[model samples]
Target: MDEDDVSVLVASLLRGDRRALARLITLVENRPRLRDRIMSLIYPYTGNAYVIGITGSPGSGKSTLVDKLTGELRTRGKTVGIIAIDPTSPFTGGAILGDRIRMLSKSTDEGVFIRSMSTRGSLGGLSRAAYDAIALLDAFGKDFVIVETVGTGQAEVDIVDAAYTSIVVVTPDMGDEIQAIKAGILEIADIFVVNKADLENVEATVMALQMMLDLSDKGDWRPPIIKTVATKGVGIKELLDAIERHRAYICETDRIEKMHYKRSKVRILEIVRSKLMDKLIRELENSGELDRIVKCVVEKKMDPYSAADEILRKLDKK
Candidate 1:
């Protein structure tokens, strides 16, 4: 699309047009060339939405919990935007398990907007376009934006960078006690949720989490462990309450400002690194230098580090 077309969409989005918002998100995701213009247009309207991240291991009922949480948020007269990151399809490279299908109940709600994205070979449990999508939702005037990461256990810590309140969900059967001690996931949670509370060993799971929290130096705010049965819409309100308390704590202490500064630093550096790498790879491929380097490495003529340095040197010369 042209610059004028993008301007029109941004205008529509600012007027709370859901179709325009969807179109803009798709444009940002698929057409990276237009991302800078689109983001610049919408950046001024963002920072109004509160972002919440829900992350956990596979089969932790995270989707069900998010569904319930969105319902509750709507009841409280809040417009909610959900970004569910799903695994990438090997064949099409699209989202394999469509979260929008799972959240069909909210499909018709005007106040609730849902979008599913594929991890697309990106790590840390989120799609590469996730940050951009969040910005679009925030700019579209949602009161709350919820990001549910692909359930990949440890690597999901990246959610902390994107959310003001980060929730880590676990189940009674997941052997989470051991998982907590081993993974960095435990360190990032603002709230720990033991979903499937009706199952056996629920107390054990809670105790394990409690023990871990006691051992860690959480400073002034300690993570609360809440038991939930998300399939039955249980403990969802309490979870939301916990989230609100954390939100209040951060706001009162002015830690939110610190978080925003840190996230901005990380986001800018990541974008710069990604853009530089993409440009370098394109240049190497077009000039056949990448192939020549690979051939030399294969034949043991040059080491990999030397090959990399040669590529950088050539780029510097150009």
Candidate 2:
């Protein structure tokens, strides 16, 4: 699409056009060249929506929790946007399981918009375009945007940077409370959710988490632990209430501003790094320097680091 088309689509998105919103997200994801313009248009309308990030181990029931939360949010007269990060498809490099399939109930609900994104080999359990997708959802006038990360266990901590409220879900049957501490998941949680509370050894799991929280210096706002059976819609209301309390606490104490500022800094640096690498690689490839360096590395004539430095030196000269 051209500049005029992008502007029109963004206008429609601001006016609550769901199709327009989906198209804009697609454009940003598949066509990286257009991402900056799209985000620049969408940024001003954001900050009105509350963003929540949910992440955990593979079988922690995060998707179910997110679905229940969306329903609860809707009953209270709120519009919801869901960004579910699924594993990348090997064939198409796109999301294999669509949001409609996972969230069949909310598919027809006009108040809720669900979009499943492929990880596309991006680490930290998020799609590379996830931040931009959140902005689009916010600009589309959603009151709440929930980002459910790909279940990559320990390395999923990046969600903290993308969300005002980050929830780390854990199951009782997962075993070994020490694993949580080791994973560094404890550090990022604004709320700790012990889902599947119906399972045995639930108390032990809860106790372990409580003990860990007591030991850690969590600053002024201590993260609360809420137990839930997400599949049966149990304890979901309490979870939502905890989320609200955290939100109010951050807003009243003016910590939300600091969080937003930190997120903005990380995002700007990420964009700059990615763009520079892309441009430098393109330049090297066109000039055959990249091929020469790879050949030398493969033949063990030069180390990878030295080859990389040589490339940078050449670029600096240009």
Candidate 3:
């Protein structure tokens, strides 16, 4: 599509055309050249939606929970946008669980927009395009935006930086899964959900999470542990209430302002780092400097660190 077409589509999106919004997301995801322009156009319109990040191990019922939450939000007259990040196929670069076959019920709802994104081999358990996608959804005027990250272990805590509220879901009989939680996931959660609560040992799982929470010092806010059966929609209302309460607490205590400042600082640094790397690589490739450095390193004429330093020096000169 040309510039005129893109502008028309952006206008349509701002007018609440879901199809136009989908097309704009696709354009931003596939075309790097259009991302900055599109984000610049939409930046001012964002920050209105409440962003929620949900993450857990595979088969922890995150999709079902999100589906139920969307229903609850819609009943309250709120529009929703969901971004489910699925693992990417190493060979195909497509989502292994793309389209979330189980969420068909919400697909036709005009007020709810669902998108499935491949992690695309990003080790952070989020797609690089996830931030841009959230911005688009917020700018499109969704009252709530939920980002369900790739099923992750303890190390993939990037969601904490991306969302206003971060929920970590676990299940009964987790056995070793509890250790994974304690390793790093515990520090990032603002709420914990013991999903599949009907199963045996549910109390033990809840107890374990509560015990961990007790040991931590979160100032005036304590992360609530809610029991839920996503498949049956049991305790969903309570879960929603917990989310709202946390949001209210954060607002009352001014934690929201601190989060906004942190997010802005992190995002700007990320953009600068990415842009500098791209510029340096392109310049080196075009000038044959990259090949020369590679040859020198291969022939033992210069060490890798020295080669990198030479590149940086050249970059500084330019």
TM-score of 2: 0.93
Q: What stretches of model 3 exceed 4 Å from their correct place?
A: 91-95, 99-101, 121-125, 153-156
Stretch of 10 with least lDDT, candidate 3: 92-101
TM-score of each: 0.93, 0.93, 0.94
Comparing candidate 1 with candidate 3, which one achieves the higher TM-score?
Answer: 3
Q: Report the number of the highest-TM-score candidate.
A: 3
Per-residue CA lDDT of candidate 1, range 1-318, in tens?
Answer: 798999999999999999999999999888888888999999999999999998887668888889899999998999999988776568744434654456547878999999887677564445558889999999999999999875554337777888999998888888844554434766788999999999999998888888788888889999999999998999999999999999999999779889889989988888887889899999889989899999999999999999999988986887
> lDDT of each structure?
0.85, 0.84, 0.83
Residues 84-145, model 2: lDDT tens digits: 87765587444346532455378789999988876775644465688889989988999999
Task: For residues 37-69, write the lDDT of model 3, one tens digit per residue.
Answer: 787777888999999999888778888999998
**Top model by lDDT, which number?**
1
The TM-score, computed over Cα atoms with residue i paired to residue i, of candidate 3 is: 0.94
